[model samples]
Target: MANHELLKLTANQVKKGNYNKAILAIGSCEAHGLHLPEGTDTLVSYKLSCMVADRVDGLLVLPPVTVGYSGHYDTFPFTITLAYDTVIQVIYDILESVLRNGINRIFLMNGHDGNIAPIEIAARKIKEKYPDARIAALPQWWVTAGELLPPDTFEVWNGLGHGGEGETSIVYYLFPEWCEKELATCVVPDHLPDKIEIKWDFAELTNTGNTGDATKATVEKGEKMTKVLVDCVVDAIKKLDAVNWDYSSTNAASKL
Candidate 1:
């Protein structure tokens, strides 16, 4: 198999490969209940990126940004929080580096909610600076996994939550030894109304430092989730490659 990991490849190998696209995994370091490891977010996104890169030709997996903005989850033990502006700058710089390397197409695989806004801002800033640059993202694979899977896949809260069924299950599938499944717990916030967004701190939602029914997570469910998520990303990258990452319509009637 051709090595698609940029970190592992030599400079000569990268030149010979002529890679033009890259995947950047953005993740966070924070508490994920008492069961999952603090590096859960990083591990999931990075692993997913590697998987996608392995299957996609000319796609390189860049080293991940392992820490992200986690101020909302700081109430939990051992949470590393970066300032929002700092996060934006970090992402911006990474994208700039990729552009400098002659790669104009980039895909961001994000593993944490708090990094969403920063990723958006950074991507936009890079686009403004380099109009020819094409950037795509899977900002929330957790939500996408739930949507892609069958309705009956998860048992509670649709497998949504920090260290919840879906997240825990994926970890169980990817890194079972890292997960203390016996210590897994959940506290679904029933008071929070659906369809109405609540800006509650991690503390306000659950004392366990996690929400949703983690006890329902299973290795089987996790395997299904991983397959769907990987397939989703693989399909997207292949389609984007087909179009040369150009979405502009050629129709004369659509011309602005």
Candidate 2:
């Protein structure tokens, strides 16, 4: 039942109904930290999407988009980004193509933090085209880190730790060898000032390119966090499906 071999197909087969409910994993190729590879977002998206697909029935996990927005990290050489409008068009075009195949349901599993705006725009436009369309996306880190990591901390090291601890642990659990424990010692910057605009540049935050105290991360913690996130997602999907709002309840549309 966990096999995705039969779930995702080529555009040709998808047009022929060879798939079911669809997912598009949006990720980025940006500097994660000196400890982790630049491909961290892509790798994580693929693994997490597969985990989600296994839990939900009729979910067809699409191959992840390895390249996504990294304008904030553009100062770092490897980082790449797409303009918000351009990405919106790309996603909209994709949904349109999928809809042509008679599949009306779609979800975007966002891996990069910066992909949010464009993805939402695409969702809104797609819904306008097909009233029955159900579209959603979430960057899994928001769910996992928010739940597991306690807020109170004496460690400023922890403050520098996003890529260091939370992200590294998730990767370690999924691909052990690729997770370098030695590199876990990367320095987390404390004196960097927060700017009004979103700082897309990883190097600006720290010379070592780490945000969190990754030394605290462990495989055990990752396993627990992953379970919690998957459970929450499953619950959310059920609740949303049952929301059954009466369109006539409020004349908000009529006022328009």
Best by TM-score: 1
State in Å the error of residue 11, model 2. Answer: 8.7
- What TM-score number comes out for model 1? 0.97
Question: Candidate 2: TM-score?
Answer: 0.79
Per-residue lDDT over 1-256 for candidate 2, one digit per residue giving the tens place of the 0 to 100 score: 5465233455554455445567777888877666677888777777777787777666677667777767777776577778777778887888887677666767677777777777888889888888877776665564455555665422344333547666777777777777667876656655655654454456666666567777776787667656766676656655554563122344356553
Best model per lDDT:
1
Question: lDDT (CA) for every model shown?
Answer: 0.94, 0.67
Query: What is the lDDT for 194 in model 2?
Result: 61
Q: TM-score for all predictions? A: 0.97, 0.79
Task: Put down candidate 1 lDDT per residue, 1-256, tens digits, no spaces.
Answer: 7778888999989889878899999999999999999999999999999999889998989999999999999998899989999999999999999999899999999999999999999999999999999999999999999999999999999999999999999999999989889989978887888799898788988888888889999999999999999999999999989998997877759546
Candidate 1 residue-wise lDDT at 100? 96
